[model samples]
Every structure is written in structure tokens, then in C-alpha cells.
Target chain A: MDLGSINPILLVASIMVSATPILLAAIGEMVVEKSGVLNLGVEGMMITGAVVGFAVAVNTGSPVLGFAAAALASAVLSLSFGVLTQVFLSNQVATGLGLTLVGLGLSALIGKPYEGMKSPTLPKLDIPLLGDLPVLGRMLFSHDIMVYLSLALVAAVWAFLKFTRAGLILRAVGESHDAAHALGYKVVRIRLMAIFFGGACAGLGGAYLSLVRVPQWTEGMTAGAGWIALAIVVFASWRAGRVLIGAYLFGGVTVLQLNLQAAGARVPVELLSTSPYLITILVLVLISARGIHGAPACLGRPFHASS
Target chain B: MIRLEKRPQPSQLWTVLTPVLAVLLTMLVGGIMFAFLGTDPLEAIRTIFWDPLFNPQFAGFTRPQLLVKAGPLILIAIGLSIGFRAGIWNIGAEGQYIMGAICGAGAGLAFYPADSVLIFPLMILCGALGGFAWAMIPALLKVRFGTNEILVSLMLVYVAENLLASVASNLLRNPEGMGFPGSRNFKQWPAAHNAELISGTGMHWGVAFAFIAVILAYVLMSRHIQGFNIRLTGEAPRAARFAGVNPARIVILCLGISGALAGMAGLFEVTGPAGQISIDFNSGYGFTAIIVAFLGRLHPVGILLAGLLMALTYIGGELAQLMLGVPGAAIQLFQGMLLFFLLATDVFTNFRLSLGRKEPA
Candidate 1:
């Protein structure tokens, strides 16, 4: 009930850090969906990245290498998903669910040795003058490399989808794979590449969690952040710019709730823990009528050239 | 280059064969995973696939647990299969299950120290209504705003879990007992206890309901007009509209029925095997039932058999974990493999693979 107790400066800083992961994942998934592929295995991919990132960071003592390894590992896992959904002509829904289960189990199994292992912290990039700015510095310029990278990735994707010929082809394939195929675009190839990029971004998000957010390895660590990312894509209406807003909004909710809990506010723990999700759902319900109009026409539908 | 040619009709042979093939492949692949972990591959596989049912040392004890385990699985999967057939995916059955337990158990606990026979039935009704109401949120949203049910349902699971933890730790914590994070043990209460109908056979009220559900589903799917609408809607949405099937009505009906059934399953589970509302009561039956629905090809009879098979793995997987030192996560991986392989092999049901095919330009 009391908003007075919350520190806006620290709150904004925390939101930036927390939003980075969801932003990375959502932005990645946005590209994949733009290419006309829907992969529900974002949660699984993120968790794999989390564990691999944590394990590698703990072993090699470098968060950068850990992030790289996490991305590579999840890309491999997502490749299996791409193969099953694309090459084998399986139902995308069922295949994506299976991928999540596999990712969770595989991450848990792989991380068994690294249980309770501390992750090497990701270093924050501090611009000499920008980082010293009065109010904006702490909120924007003072974050780990991943936060800036996440913003950069969003801008890059926005530019790619808007200005580049490849982006046009990706959007075309998403609009109608048949037409794209008729236009001599390798629909499956474009989709697979998008899927790979999506996987790598999701991995980066997971790595950010393990290396920077919590700075440790824990089972089930991602804790539905990947799902929030999925919802954000829809909330963003598949636009790269809106995706940033959606992630930040969600991240703000999460941090605000935690701050409420920490400030000894009388709000029950259950409501606080689940408020972010409930708020996201509420937002989804509000905008849903207008939301899905921008979704890729062939988003969840599998492509088959022979058909 | 390889190509997939659509068959005029789905192959009947592969429908029944895919689950079996998937199981065999899981064993083969899972065994390799176990070997990499340095366990004896054959022993691990045998332990997971064979020992619990056929091994004399474990069968007497594990056999009775199969129904106990499969009862809720079958109940939930039957509901899921119904919705899935109508192409309305209610992925958050887990949340429904937890809510059902809370409402049913909460109602019973309110009447503690009373011995009325009507209490149990009333609790059952409350349980069903609780789940139905929870599920209706997503159903109505989809019908009204065109929101995706899958994401909404899935998000509700985390909400439900938090609610569960809160209830156990604060709201429903046993007052008489020394500050514990669970409700009063319903199994020990005479009026609310879900006692087994046939002693030593695992024929509790839940198991009986599961059997009745299977029979009811079979009849409805085979003889009912509503069932036809559901099947038609799933297979051909446009054709169903032409045939006078109402999509919104179907969505409500399917979600309501599935939610009610899942609620009953949770109610029965809390009262019987689980004994009370605890912080970590849910064991992923809601999620696992999805695999069962798919593994059974979304058929009633197939779901019944698939439920039993999945239950066998649950019991056997624990046995493998205890005896062979196979990690718990491996069993989950194996279950996931079942769904993946099932979907992979199911491609053959609707299409034929051809080699070096060139399309006529």
C-alpha cells in the first residue's frame, strides 16, 4: 500500500538488470516468430544456458566464456527441436513441450556436479561520463555488459527486420511460407537460422541470470522467466520496440514486488511472488483483442515444401 | 532429397504402433544415457521397464501402488485428451488440480470434529466447482478477447503453486499440531477419509472414479453428438462451423469438463494417498498427463492403457533411482523422450516418406 518506502533509483537499476534477461529472450523469440516459427522451448533453452553458464563460469572463472558456452549448448538443444519440428514434421506444440521437459531434465542432470557452485559475476561496463550522470547513470549506464547488449540486440533486430533484405524474406516466409517458397526463398533454411538466433539469445538471457542476476547455480533457476518472455512477445505485438517496453514493464513489476516484500510491507508473500505474472496476464487480457493482429500469420504452423 | 507425401487417409496401423515404438526407443536411448553415467545399462533399463511389475521382490508392494499412482493420472489425462481433441489446450491442469485440493480439503477442514456423511460429497462438489471456476478464466478470455489459452493456463500454474504454498504455510496450517506447514491429515479423519473400496486391491474412491471416467468417456466419444462436434472441430474447424458446431460453446464445455475432472482427481489425491494439503503436494501429474494423452493418441481406451504404462514408469523409475543410483532427472528425461519419439514416429501415420522425389513444375 505504501509506495513511499520504495527507492526509485535502486528500483530502476534493479529493473534494468532484471529486465535484461527477459528482454534478451523475448527479442530472440521475436525474431524467430518473425521468421514464421514458434518455439515454445524458450524455457528449456534458457535453463540449459543457465546451468551451462553457471558451470563454465565456476570452472573457468570467466562469465564471458560461460555466456558463450551457454549459448552454444542451448543452440544445440534447440537444433534438436528444429530438426523434430522442421525435418520430421511433428506437431509444433507437442514438440515444443517435449523440448522443455528435455531441457529441464538435461540441465538438472548436467548441473548435478555443480550444485551450490558460485558463478563468476559478470562485470558491469561503466562509461566514464555517462555512468556518472545524476539520475540516469545508475539506472542506465551502470549495468552489466548484458543489459547494454540486450538493448543493442533489440535495435539490431529492429533494423534487421525493417531495413535488410534478409529481414524482408524472413517476414515474407512468416507471412506465407508457400509464397516465400514460390519466390525461391528457402523457407526452412531461413526458419532454421532464425530458430538458432532465437536459441542463442535465450541462452544469453539465462546466462545473464546465473552470472549477473543471482550469481550462482540453482536448479529451476530461470523459474518461468522464459514464459514471461513468450508472453512479452505477444504483448509487444511482435514489434521489436514494443518488446523492450514489455520486458521493462514486467521487470519493473517484479522488482517493485520484491521491494515491497523487503520493505516489510503487509502484503502477503504469495501475492508478491505471483503479482508479476498476474499483472502480465492482466495486460495480456487487456490488449489481446488488438495484440495478435501483428503476429506472424504462419507463426505456429509448420512448413513443408512437399505439401 | 527426401519428401513427405500426404496419405489419403491416416494409417490405422501406426496409430497403435507409435506409442510402443516410442517406448522401445526411449529404453534404447535412455540406456545409453545411463551408460554414460557409469551405471549398468541393461540393469538400469530392466529396472525401469521390468522390475516393478514382474520382479517378485517388488511386485507385491508396487502392484497395488500402480492404481494408486495411475488413478489421478488417468482421471486428469482423460480430461486433457477430451480438450486436446477439440484443439483447446488446457495446459494448466496442474493449477486446477491444486485449487481442487484446496477447496475440497478446506471445506472438509472447516467441519472438523463433525462426522456427517454429507461432508465428503459436498467437498467433492466444491473441489469440482473450484477447478471449473479457475479454468473458466482462460476459457472466457479466449472466447471474449481471443487470448491464447496455452499461455494463460501455463501462467496460472505458478500462481496456483504460490497460492498452495501460502495456504499450507499460513492459511491452512494445522492449529493443533506444532506449527507445521500443512493442513490436518484428512486420511486420519473418518468422515473425510478416501478409504479404499476393495481392501488390498488399491480400489479407492479415486480409482473407482477413474474406471467410471474411462467408461463414461468411451461411451460419450462413441455415441454422443457433442463428441462428434468436438472431434469435427479439431479435425476441421470450418467444416464443424458448417455442421452447426458452436466454437465458443465447445470451448466452454471442454474446459469446464476437463477442469471438473481434474478437480476431482486432486480432491481424491489429497484425501487419500497425499493425506493433506502440503507445500509441495503436486508431483507433476497434471503435466505428465499431457504425455499420456498424446501417447494414447487421444483415445479413451488408449489413455487408460497409457496411464497405466506411465504409472508403471513412475513406480519403476523410483525403484531404479533407489537401486541403481540413476538420478531422478533421468526418469524425467526418459518420459520426455516418450513424447518426442511418439511425435516423431507419428509423422508416418499421416504421410509416407519417399526418396529422391522431384515435384512436377
Candidate 2:
């Protein structure tokens, strides 16, 4: 029950690490949704990335190769989803759920040999000047590169959606695929790209779990993180900056819960563990109740050029 | 170049053919996958699709287990089909299932050491109500706040899992069994056990309920006004609204039905085969039922057949794992492939591929 045992600096530092996966996933999904596509296979993609990343890192002894392979594998996996939904015009929700099932099964099959195996983890990058700073350096500058990369990605996504014509076109495609197609834009192709990008980001997030966070391979390791990321997208109202805040807020809750458990708080362990999911649900309710649902108009709609 | 043209109406022929086609496609692709895993492809496929039902050594025991496995799947899928028909996604049936088992089992356990016939019926009622109430959360939110039921329902699964662990370890721990994290075995309590009505046939109360649900669902979908409304809502929401269909009522009704069925399935499992409320009582029946609902074309009869087919995969997958050294996860991958192929082939239902170049507009 002694709350003083919890280190504030370490808590902030760990929040960055904890939030990286969801941040990466949410940002990518944001892009995909912005392009008027909803790919609910984030969990599947992330888990695939986790296993592939772990296997590659273990075999090659290189975390970088592991991350790249994970991104590629998930991107390829997402293409299957893109093809089914975009090219074949399958129902997006069902196809996405199928993708998740496939990912879970495939990852488990591939991860069988790698169970309990440890992989090379990502190295932390300490900013030369900032590393020596008082509390700020310890809180932010000393985290792993993925944490920074995820933050940079949020900023990049914000800029891309805000200042870029291609981003606008992507948004246009998402808002009304028919309009985009009539304007001579390849709606399906753009959606496929966005789906691919989403998969890659989900992969990086999953790889972060196995290679950096957990630092070991376990079956079903991503364990609802992808779903949380999806909830974060809704909580953020599909805005990039709010997505960052949502991820950090979720990360803060997760870290705080774990810290409470470690500090032997009076709350039951199960309640503490369940807090993150409950918090996500609460945030979703609060956000949705505000009626600020900025979901893309064409989200989850199958695109067929022929109408 | 090939071109797809939308059919004036959905093809009934393709509707019946897709599931069969999807199964064959799964066997072919799954065989190749098995081959890569160093198992004999034909042997693995045969073992998965054939051995469980036909192998003389195992068929005697596996035959009845098929009913045991399919019973819950059919029940849950029947519920999900209703919601899916109205374009309402209640993806968190797994959570509802857990809650149902908890409430049903807890109710029965409260009357522990008492010999009363009413206990079992009361448990059933509690189980169904438990699931229905759990489902109402997402339904109410969606109706009131415009919340996405898919995400909310899915999120609740995690919450439910945690709650399950908590109850199993703390609230319902078997006191007489040296502090183990499970309730008293229902098998030992004849009053609460959902035992097989026809011994050795695996026909329990759950299986009976599943059959009843199939006929009921079939009637509801084909012969009822509510069915028409559900279909209309899915196909044309605006038209449905114009026809005086209350969208909120439909959402609530659909979610409630699915949740109750899923919950009943869970209660039946915990009482019958599982024999107790444990942390891992749910075997992903809720999620797998989603695939069942889709594969059956959201039709009750289709779901019944699909449920049995999926049940065969489960039994066969286990047999394959034991006999051919196939990894257990391969079966999950196989099921996933079935859904993927089904969705891919479903394109034929509404569109026909033209082999020639498209006509100029």
C-alpha cells in the first residue's frame, strides 16, 4: 500500500515504452480509416509481427532485421485482407475478423518452435544532451528508439493528413470512394496502400512487444493490445494528436495499475489487471457520448469501381 | 480482362455452393500448409476431415463428442445470426458466454447440497438472463450514444476474462478441494448437471436446446415479420425506417437474443462437459460461432450444418494432433482459412464474372 515505492520518473519513462505499440498501431489505423477503410485485423497483424519479429531476431541475432521482417510479413498478410475486401469486394468486418483468426492461428503455428525463446531486443537511444538532464532526460530521452519512432510517426501522420495533397486525396477516397473513383483516383489501390501501411505499423507495434517489451516469445503475447489500439482510435475521434494523448493516457493507466499491483495495493490483482480494458471502455463511452464521432464517412464500406 | 457485373438479384445457387466450395478450398490450402510443416499432406487432410468420423478405432467415441462440441456452437451461432441479419455486430458474445456461465453456475452453487429440481431450471434462466443483461450494455450504448458495438463488445471479452479469473480463484474456489481455483464439479451434483438425455449419444440439454433453436430461428427468419424487418434493416436501413421498423428496438432485440444464446451455451458447457466454472471454461466458442454464422449464410439451417462441420474440425483437429504430430494451432489456422475462403467465394453470390472485355459505357 506504500505508494511512495512507485518511482514517478520511471513511471513516465515506462509509459513511453508501454504506449509505443498502441501508438504505432492507432496511428496506422487512423491513416487506413482516413482513407475510408476500416481494417479490424490490427490484432492479427500485430501478433503476426510479434512471432515473425521474434523468430527473425532469434535466428539472425539482429533486432533491426526482425522488425523489418515483421513489417513485411504483416504487410503481406494485410494484402490478403486488402485483396478480399477491396478487389474481391468482401464484407470488411467479416474479412477483418477472418484476418484476425488467420493471424492468431498462423502466428501460433509459426511461434511453436520459438516458444519461451528470447530474442535480441531493441537498443535504447539516449539523446547526448538530454540524457544528462535532470528528470526530463530520465523520463523521455532515455527510452528505446521505437518509442521515439512512434511519436515521430504521430507527428508525421498529423502532417501528412494536414498539409499533404496525397493525404487529402486519401481522405477524399475514404470519405467517398465513389467520388474519388469518379475523380479518376484509384480508390481500391489507395485503400490497399493504406491497409498495407496499417499492417506494417501494427507489425512494428507487435514486434515491440516481443523484441523489446516482453523480450521473449509467447503464444498470444499481444493479448488485446490491438483491440485497445482500436478503442484508442475511437477515443481520439480519429485525430492524430488526440491519438497520441489517448495512447499515453492508456499507457499511464496500464503502468499505474501494474505499479499498484507491485506495491501491494489493497485492490484485488484481478481488478487491477482488468483496469486497462475497463478504462478503454470508459474512455470510448465518454468520447462517443460527446457526439464528436469523426469516423470517416466511408469506413468499413467495400469498394467496387463498377457501382 | 475479366470484369465483375452486379447481378440483378443474389444468386440462390451460389448461396448454397459457397460453403462447400470454401471447405474444399480450405482442405487444399491447408494440405499445402501441412506439407510445409513436414507432415504428409494427404494424411493430414484425411486425418482432419475423415478420421474422426470414419476411423473405426476412434469413431465410436468421437461420434458422440461431435454433438457435444457442435451443440454450443450451433446455439451461439443461431443467436449471432439474428444480430448479424440486422447489421448489428455483437462481437462480444464470448463475454456474454462467460457471464452466463458465471451467473448460472453461481446460482446453482448457491443452492448447493440441496436436492431440488427447480435449481437446474433456475440456473438456466439465470444463465440466459445473465448473457442478455451483459449484452444490453453495448446495445444501450449503441442505441443511446452511437457507440460502436464491435469494439465495445470485443473489449468486454478482456474484462470478462479477468472477472472469470477473479471468481474462479476467489469467489467460487472449490473449498473442499484444497483451495484450487474452480467451483464444485457439477457432475457430482445431479440436480445441476446438464447430463445427456440419451446416454452414450452426447445428447444433453444443450444439444436439445440447439435443435430447438435451429427450428425456432428458421421459423423466425422465414415466417415472421420481425425477420423481414431484420433483413430490411440490413439491406436498406432507410427503407426499414420508412416501413416503421424501430431501429433501436431491433438493435436491442438482436443483441439480447445473441447474448442469451451465447450465455446459455456457456452455462450448458460448464454444467455438462466442463463440469465446473473454471478460469478457462470458455473455449472460444463465442468467436468461432461468428464464423459459423457467416459460413451458414446467416441462416439457421446453415448454421446447424456449419456447426456440425466446425465440430468435426475440432474433433478431427484433436485427433490429427495426437496421430500425425500436427500442431494444434494448425486447426485454428484451418478454420480461419475456411472463413477467408468463404468470404472470398461469397463474391459470386451478388456478382458474375464476365470473361470478355467490359462493354463501353
Using all chains and alpha carbons, the TM-scores for the candidates as numbered come to: 0.98, 0.99
Docking quality (DockQ) for each candidate:
0.78, 0.90
lDDT of each: 0.90, 0.93
Worst 10 residues of 1 chain A by lDDT: A286-295
DockQ of 1: 0.78
Please give the interface root mean square deviation for model 2, in Å: 0.7
| Model 1 Cα RMSD, 1 decimal | 1.4
Q: How does candidate 1 score on lDDT?
A: 0.90
TM-score of 1: 0.98
State what share of the real interface contacts each candidate retains. 0.69, 0.89
How big an interface RMSD has model 1? Answer: 1.1
